[model samples]
Target: EDCPHREKNGWMGDAHLAAEMAFYNYDVAHGYTKWLADIADEQRPSGEVPGIVPTAGWGYFFGNGPAWDCSLFLIPWYTYLYTGDVSIIEKQYPSIRRYIDFLATKANEHHIVAWGLGDWCPAKTETPAEITSTAYYFKGAEILSKMATLLGDSGSATRYAQLAEDIKASFNRQFYRGNGIYGNGSQTALACALYQGLAGEYLTETVDALVNLVKSNNYHLDCGILGAKYLINALLDNGHADVAYRIVSKRTYPSWGYWVEQGATTLWERWDGENSRNHPFFGDVGAWFYKALGGLRIDEDRPGFKHVNLNPIFPEDLDWVDVHHESRYGNIKSSWKREGKHIHWEVNIPNNTTATVFLPLGRQGEVREGGKAIRQSIARINIIRETDDMKVIYLTSGEYTFTFVNDQD
Candidate 1:
């Protein structure tokens, strides 16, 4: 149920968006895996997946678009990423390919498939539904290609890879113009293009335009439900963490802070609190705090957290952040604080696990671990790389304290 008081439907899009945060915050593998099985069982013969699994037969007749149907691919893919369990992918592969093939049948002459709910909720935007829908189509194909490669299905991998490339070319040809311009110049359209890797050569330009779009909106998000989840990440990935931080920390109408200001104890279904005040769909931003601000990430190559990556981003406005997660391997920890021009970072990597810690540094010779300068020959520590912005260090499982000075004034 999206909310206890409202229509208690199992909306697929909401589940897709909230899956990451749910896995990160809790152990939901058993329940979620069962739900995926139900979704697979309910898939219609026409290759159309219902927008809500275990449906009352309402979502099938309508609202079953790529944005809604994408849970078929995303949920299992994310499960594989988080848990390192390939059984879900193996089980869902047929249904996943069937859904993608169904979407292919909906493609226009340009090979851009577009038929779905663009961005649910009311917002001022000139972006078309086709852009968002087709972008998701491409995203699904891309993920499927990766899944095939992972499963050693070389033929399927090649097929889906080619399909993804074709879709990317079609998307760029249909929407992208010279520079950063996209269809309707809407934030959602641009975000999809950038975040979905459809921007190609125009990535930097698109990012700059996106930053300007947010600044033009006074640092307020302009995307609705579907695009909102990607907006913060797109901004942060494109060298605009400052803007991302500002948006998440804003306290006004159409912002998360607005809900907090209204004395609401939970994330609202709508940004305006127009409907159910307790919904977790739009709460994907919480994952960003853990990834970007708190700087804890599971290594994709070593999924199930066999290898941890500690890359904390210390925002200028934030003084300190503390984060911990209990992985199947062991407990992972990262705590950091800034006092004047110096930063104190403490990290704990569990036994039998290793980590690559990226410590922000202002200049060379500014980093010291356990009161000793980091060196290539240091025991259990190896300096991977050094740039003006950060010092990347590789460490075996152990507790370590590092200090660096901010030389920039």
Candidate 2:
């Protein structure tokens, strides 16, 4: 009864869970797709989806509003990218388009979409603009624009792209505080803008900012399990792949795994670095663990057999890893073991696609999978799986992985 904010459905938790499921287990495709549908059902006519559905009890968090609504727009694109189902995009297009239109109405002369009320709106005041909010806004609009183009809605595409560009320009002009740094929405906004390609020519600067954010632990404390997961993704996407890998693998107290290792069935709200169970932001920490650690990416661009880079930076003491993911294309299970001389790698990619597997860097060798001798060239190989068959590639020494369902193959 105390959870007046979210009751109708576990909105915040569900979004994070959807990302977890979509990335970790391939079997949950139907359930994940249905979850997105359920969310669309609750969307207000005004294009504002509450952070917490009334049915779920929790309405929204204190720091921000509308900022989370942008995730609603991302859900459909995430699904379509995996299933390659133009139908999903078509089904969600009208609603998404309407939402974008609504956001445009909210935009100021600067084309910057304002976050709701005082939530994260610059020093937590009633400022008209905020970097974090606009970052998500532009990023979402850009994705929607791409989806619109894919759906042949040139008008919507142009409109959304223009809006996205406007927001990006505004973000660079306003949020960037010099020294290749950014503020507002913490590093989360900075990373999202860059990873989503809204950073333009400033990718390196944005990437540097992301590194600085992680180093400074800005979002780390402000984030709960869910926020940390998203933060990790932003780092990985913006050329900080190595740092992202460290955040995932680090087992020190207060880490993602630390909570799981403490005999907790689900993820804890706060890390040991923060408060314990009494923390106000507590939800499901287990959800974020599998998602970020499993390296399950929700991409809107690749429809079949999406690109996966198996680069995990584990501590010297911690080595082996195994993960299984269920996608719209099908199921993929990957395993990696660090042998003294080489990494024993095995990947089972399902039917109807090809996987470009990257052999360990600097290592040289040929391995077999799907009943064929995988050719090793330039320390990487493209393993193409047609139908129910599989494709496997071997690696030498150093570090390496593959990009499955990529544009190249």
lDDT of each: 0.83, 0.53
Cα distance off (Å), candidate 1, residue 69 = 0.9
Worst 10 residues of 2 by lDDT: 118-127
* TM-scores for the candidates: 0.95, 0.72
Q: Model 2 has how many clashing residue pairs?
A: 28
Q: Give the poorly placed runs of model 2, Cα more than 4 Å off.
A: 1-8, 12-23, 26-29, 32-44, 54-64, 117-129, 216-227, 251-253, 272-301, 306-316, 328-330, 363-409
Clashes of each: 0, 28
Per-residue C-alpha lDDT of model 2 across residues 265-300, encoded as one tens digit per residue: 544334653323322223323333333334344433
Candidate 1: worst-modelled 10 consecutive residues by lDDT: 118-127
After TM-score superposition, the amount by which residue 404's alpha carbon in candidate 2 deviates from its true location, in angstroms, is 20
Q: TM-score of predicted model 1?
A: 0.95
